[model samples]
Target: MSLAQPLAELLEAADRPLEDARAMPPGVYTNPEFLSHEIETIFSKEWICVGRSSRLAKTGDYLTYDLAGQPVVVLRGKDGQLRAFSNVCLHRMSTLVEGCGNKRVLVCPYHAWTYDLDGRLRGAPFMTQTTGFCKENYALPPIRCEEWLGWIYITLDKDRPGVAAALGPLEKLIAPYEMENYVECFRETHVWDTNWKVLAENFMESYHLPVCHAATVGGHSRLEEMECPPGLEAFNYHWITKEASLPMGNAHPDNRRLEGRWRKTTALITLYPSHLITLTPGYFWYLSLHPKGTGQVSIVFGGGLSPEFMADPRAEEYVATLKGLLDEVNAEDRGCTEKVFRGLSADAARAGHLSYLERPIHDFMRYIAERTGGYRRAFAVAAE
Candidate 1:
């Protein structure tokens, strides 16, 4: 069988371009209409990494999260099965749960409508005699959900393809990790005043690592030695980096000792729309991007590892180090992206092209265009 055209072109271009051949379009980051379309077409149609699967390890455990402004609840039933439902209460359309917890039944704080762990409507405080108030039909609407590599992924579309099918080549790349064995050690949510696409693109390529994150994460590896395999159409890549040979300037006095501990790191991962996963030597981190508006994005960072790692005293210290490194890198990214957003909004440029160094982002944009049937329209707008 012959390779697809996009895939073939991507592979051929991967080795040739040292810089972006095309400018990244401004609409991807600054246009409200484009942002709305992305939320509806990109986010709702694809599988999104939510939280860690271990968050629902026990029966009755539940967590509430917002996905592109939609409130969702993930729960583990008494039978030890995982399920997801819209967090809106059936009676008054109020949120049934506010946060994560173990509950025998999810009772709406507004009108006291109750639901079982399976999302079946079990009780209502009032309307016992009301006609057409059957509990059978009042169950919370379910969202399609699946667990992969210790992460919980959900899709708003009930009929959309399963996570395994959607991930395609990425699943095979991450298969060796056995991520299900890891336990979550840390999770954090931060709001950024930038478009979600900016965050996705920033994470997809390491071209800026040398310039932007030079102090913390950037100095830890040599960018020149990094190798990106052929094929933009492939879902993932193998990023191999030699460990730090020397100490990074003491950004933190306490972490100065960890300079040359790790010998090498291999991040075998993929960028599926707005989600990103990175496997470090000691642990794994997943970032989920949920766009709030044209200029705002909600980011959730989740970390996973074995229970022993979580319980270790040194692990806490390591987490602190990691968090500090991430804070610096993320702040740098946010500063640049926010500035870019502002510039794009002020200029009103219709489009831009992608650089050769940004093949992953280009591939993603292509995928989105094909899926939404917007490639032709986007190109036409650019031409004008």
Candidate 2:
């Protein structure tokens, strides 16, 4: 099928320089056909982040997620290794697991077909009498899984590059924060009424923080103090320096890794398709998004404190404070992004010139365009 007109136009806009860029067109968010295209091209091939490795701290701990149309389960096995397997029963094709939990063995609820933690078929009831039924032939298929800087990522495309190699430079850029050492205090999932891209763009820019987040982090954000630099091949980033609205937003008194300005600065990073991270000196949080059709998004929202804060005497209080503040901030973001989606569906919705603060969104649009087969036409705008 040919590319849709609205999405084609959006790709053209995405190629422009920061001074001339515009908001993406509305149809890209509202079109079911376009979402399907994205699922096939981007979600299926990219290294999609499931969550932080800290959540699965023990053997047999597992979490389930649906990528595109495939059911997936990421689990820690008896050998202290993490693995991803298809969460489908080989017998009747029923889903093996639903959510996150500890499972000694994967037991299919449909007919009690059991599988070992390593994806081997351990048992299958009532199949002995059947002719030509060999348990040895069955096993949960393994998916491509890897750990990069404490975060777990999985990909359906076996040939895709490993996360560590793809994000090597990112590790060096964030080395001082020691991201892997941050202890995850909480992880929650929510379904919101907005296109996934809308939510992603909201997190990519702090332009709306002073207004949309007025009741929370608004007062602490200074537009002029924000910095937007050119993005790299794998990711985009921006920096915001200010007196943190929450104490945990700054470095702990015990922190020795960061000095002077680094203590008060926050890095807002977007890792290709949809991993958004806000890393501060004392804490870090992230949102991993998946589309739930044209009008909704599935979000894996999680965060926690740095090693210094985790080792502090008031760690419990700090965790409570950080969780409470993040909850409020998420509520504000949901409200703003949902409103943008609603407006996009209106007849009068038209693309508008972008602010310098929204440079990352422009970069994100270009990434999507490239993945969805619009790259040839999209990059032409850049050359012009």
Per-residue lDDT tens digits for candidate 2, residues 1-384, read 234775677667767877898888888888888899999999999999999898998999999989988999999999999999999999999999988999999999999999999999999888889999999999999988899889999999989988888787778888888898998899989999999999999999999988999999999977899988777667888889968888889999989999989899899999988999999999999999999998999999999999988998999999999999999999999998899999999999998998888988888888887887557423222100
Please list the residue runs of candidate 1 whose C-alpha ends up more than 4 Å from where it truly belongs after superposition.
Answer: 1-20, 231-234, 244-263, 306-313, 348-355, 374-384
Compute each candidate's TM-score over C-alphas.
Answer: 0.81, 0.96
TM-score of 1: 0.81
Q: Can you write out model 1's per-residue Cα lDDT over 3-87, one digit (the tens) per residue?
A: 2333333333332333644444554555566666667777877788878878788988988878767899999989888899999
Clash statistics: count for each candidate: 10, 0
In candidate 2, which residue ranges exceed 4 Å CA deviation?
1-3, 376-384
